[model samples]
Target chain A: MQSEFAVELRDVVKQFVTPEGNLLNAVDHVTMQIKNGEFFSMLGSSGCGKTTSLRMIAGFEWPTEGEVYIEGKPMGHTPPFQRKVNTVFQNYALFQHMTVYQNVAFGLEMEGADKNEIEKRVKRALEMVQLTGMERRKPRQLSGGQQQRVAVARALVKLPDVLLLDEPLGALDLKLRKEMQLELKALQQELGITFIYVTHDQEEALTMSDRIAVMSKGKVMQMGTPVEIYERPANRFVADFIGESNFLEGKIKSVSADEASVFVPALNAELSGVPMSKDFVNGEEVVISIRPEKIRIVDADAEKDGVFRAKVINSIYIGSDTHVFLDCNGVRLKVMEQNHISRLDPHSFYHKDQAVGVYLIPENTLVLKKEA
Target chain B: MLQRLRENKAWQGTLLALPTTLWLFVLLVIPLFLTLVVSFGRRSPDGGVIYGFSFHNYLRLIGYSTNCPAGQSACFDPLYAQILWRSLTLAFWTTVIVILLAYPLAYFIARSHPRRRNTFLMLVLVPLWTNFVIRVYAWMMLLREQGVINGVLGWIAAQFGLPFQPLQMLYTPGAVLVGMVYEFLPFMILPIFTSLEKIELPLYEAAADLGANPFRTFLRVTLPLSMPGVVAGTILVFIPVMGTFIVSDLLGGKQVILVGNLIQNQFLSARDPTFGSAASLILMIMTLIVTYFYTRKFGFGEEIITA
Candidate 1:
């Protein structure tokens, strides 16, 4: 029976020797399964092995210890040409010597397709990317966005079982990158091809991926749907890497089934939070993290379960949200208030040294194990 | 004063070019004009130019001889024509062999580890440090009948208890070709290596990622990208090989009478500067025509033509 996963990396590890003669694991022992027609992304900053993982899937690299399986078949030393996958490179590595038509048709020609077939498919691919009239121009003659689209068309023309994109929009400007992100998502859906994308941009992954594997160092820190990863992070690294969070170091005052009350010295009161990981014991150290946007600034006299009186340290008027810095007891927290109503009056905005109440919902506050 | 000098860009440019321009005008332009003038003159009885207009030397180069069989007014000797043709063929064969030998070595060096590449390139250039004539003499030592190669063969035959005769290797066409190949090899390698090394690694990955095997990638990407270097090396090796006489003179002995040896004989031995000047002009024209056609086809070696 064939496995359901389109690609699987079983405990794969890739090691490299730095120039200074240190053995480093570029991709640590990691395992993942990507379903067919799913848009999966490996997200991390540079040197975090995201690209290395994608390259191993593309057959440009081999697992140092384990095996990579595609369609339930082990890819043991199979070269990229023999593999049923193609990659749109980070820099749009198009053949500068070949014209756009020739570049897109390169893969089909390698497969020994006849002239009529190559021409028809190349024309169709170019049209899919909206580059129909750009066939005769060379790669250098096109703009960056156009070149990136050509790279996509070239890789997609072969209709591989899986498509790998290594930060394909990294070279484009911000505005163009956003547009390509939506276009790429729409394209992936229309074609129903499995895409293994690698990028360091967390927002891009959150925007386009069916699931994101946020990596740090050389290991997968967390892997889940975008909302799951954002709203409920697996650890401190994932929470901090995904979005801005205010972390308070504290000792567990009491432990319940899924909730823990942590005694934070900075707050001078026991704050209740849901533990992200299990095995929470009383007097154990943990960090309670609350996202900046999750905090609310209510009236000082309002009675709330997770509310504390605080003085506004500063305020910044941003269009979508107003960021208010506050000091509650001895702890500092940044509260983001969405502009639900127009604050035309000057007093409507929070001013310096104003008394306010900072509220952190027990469910929204994540109690995570403290990492060194 | 410094600001004034920098402000006049045209004057600064002229001043910077003064040394080279004066040098070329005196040493290159004046001599080339003199050679052309002397090419049209007649030969004196002595070794000086007679200074008269005639196409006798040019005509003789194409096999027309004023001094022929006594009864005939003119006849084709085919002597000068044969020498020119031999020179052309030798240069062509030498260039072809050098490229065949140089390209793989150059590619190997370019693809080697970065630290070792400099050492390999240095090895290719080490032979050039020796004098050209001395290097030709060294080839003579290896190709002579009693040379190291023949001595080894003789020793091998003696061990087998078989009688052997010393093989005549020097003063032959093959020896001349070998000597030429050895001398001009580095010239062909450097330019090819430069061009091959300039091809980015991503181009190869792109080709392989597009379903091309290693062989196809080399053919489609590596070969086309490195053509500029091959063209540059060809021009650099071909022209000099055609006009060089020391190799053919020493290694070919009396057997190889190329245009270079013929030109040298005219001025020093035959006491005919007019003929030598005409021959020199013909060699220059032949080299220019070949280069013109080659550059017109390949675009002046695509910016790496060292010459």
Candidate 2:
């Protein structure tokens, strides 16, 4: 059975009055659903309204126009403390004066729980975050990662209906961030609580989210699994945003159930893929995006296969792999090759300014719909 | 040798602090040492130091001798101790009153919007910009029998056709307290406000999310975080009020005498520098002990608010 949505925002709009007498819309009419027991993420750049949307669900802010519902109950003008949601702010917002135990027990104290129960839940939550003995330590005494875990424990101890994390890993270094991402995903799974994560980092969204809603300009552009977002992006923005991809402008020549032929102007050749939207007609201008890894470097003399002759612009050695950049049909594409015994052959290393044959698999090419 | 000198950071720090060390030695250490010496020395008939070591000065502090036609003989007096006790009581009450009034005002200023906060702070500080003597005189004028307060009270009574005289409000302990609080109120507000203002808003939000409501958040987070200011303000207001002579002299008239007024009398009126220095040294010692106690109790931990 599918888990029900724990938090839902229906056509919510949030606006702020600017000093110039203009109403600046931070979050437009956006609707979203976060499933219970799932680590859902709102992924976007700064000023993309992802945080605002999360804050709406957390009841920190009331929508200018629309309703937010938690567990199917309408939440109208509810303050943050009254809501069954806790947020982990980017800075970890720990109480400077409180010990970790006191910070974690804050919610329980608010609920007027018995002292024993508060202590038990706080201990349990701290244990869940792997901060058992550090409960009595002040937040400043902890490292960034430990402080972040304390913030998580503070929210988790409340057993809120949903845990909202707003760039919780943004302050961490790369290695710590990667570790916390995995720990957070595992913690979400173990606690069985809905986690609504907000971040502008695409790698964070890809690594932790069950599904991500790609936001831009105060609106959700696409919502899908990370693989789906990378492989079959609905529009040009998603294809460019999710990962490294090279695009070519083309015109649709023909359409079929499984494939669509487009006139590739650079190579004067026909490109084929399944268009994401069916509304595209003949002679419609479209963009085709092919992931960099899809392009393969082949020997120019290796049989006249479906390949184009190109020049290698640059080659980079990245420890475990070598990235070869080639200019194909006036478009730059990168090909990554894992360093291995066979690849160690002297002739296998392609240098810059060398002529090479680049082949792109038809199935790997993504046909994107034009966004108005 | 150059490299070794560059590496000697502890020596560099000590060198940097040398000026302050010398300053303290000259201003603080020397005077205290001198005061101790004077407390044990004898005072001449003209109130100058005779440089003779004796217990007579100490004996004279508790009870002096009456010089008749014969010679100096012992008499008894406990008035100084009683005065010291009264001074302690006044200082204690002044601290309590300042804390009670300063807390809410400081809280409001600390949490208010930037523009409004500055405006409110300006209001609190406006009275301080005027001359201290003038502010005290203003209070003196208001509390006097023929002043605005009594005139207003008399007018109200006459408007209602009641037979009554203006109430005696000036020259009382209440008037002294009013003047002391007015003079020192801003000292209390500023420190508490600075501490409260330094508290991050997210801390309060975090506290609330942990299940605290507004008041609980204030008690747990706001109060404790602002303890530095509260303690600083308390010490600042208490020490000065204890040593203050103007409020009691102007308002208490001859009805009451705080320790500050007594110390002032010993310096100027009694012209007994030896006894004055002894009492002054006692007050200074009390101040140092209280300050030491507060600093030792609260030195290097999170500021604690008993509330």
Every candidate's DockQ is 0.42, 0.53
Tens digits of per-residue lDDT, candidate 1, A1-372, equal 656999999999999999999999999998999999999999999999999998888888888888899988899899988998999998988877678998898899889999999999999999999999999898989999999999999999999889999999999999999999999999999999999999999999999999999998889999999999998888889999998899989999888888888988887878876655557888999999899998888998888777889999999989988999999887889888898889888878988998888888878888888992
Across residues A50-77, which tens digit of lDDT does each residue of candidate 2 receive?
9989888876678999899998888998
- The ten-residue window of minimal lDDT in model 2 chain A covers A271-280
Top of the candidates by lDDT: 1
**Positional deviation of residue A152's Cα in model 1 after best superposition, in angstroms:** 1.5
Candidate 2: give the clashing pairs: A106-B210, A107-B210, A107-B211, A110-B211
* Deviating ranges (above 4 Å) for candidate 1: A1-3, A253-257, A273-279, A316-322, A339-352, B1-22, B300-307
TM-score of each: 0.94, 0.91
- Alpha-carbon error at B76 in model 2, in Å? 7.3
The clash tally of candidate 1 reads 0
**Ignoring the other chain, what TM-score does chain B have in each prediction?**
0.94, 0.88
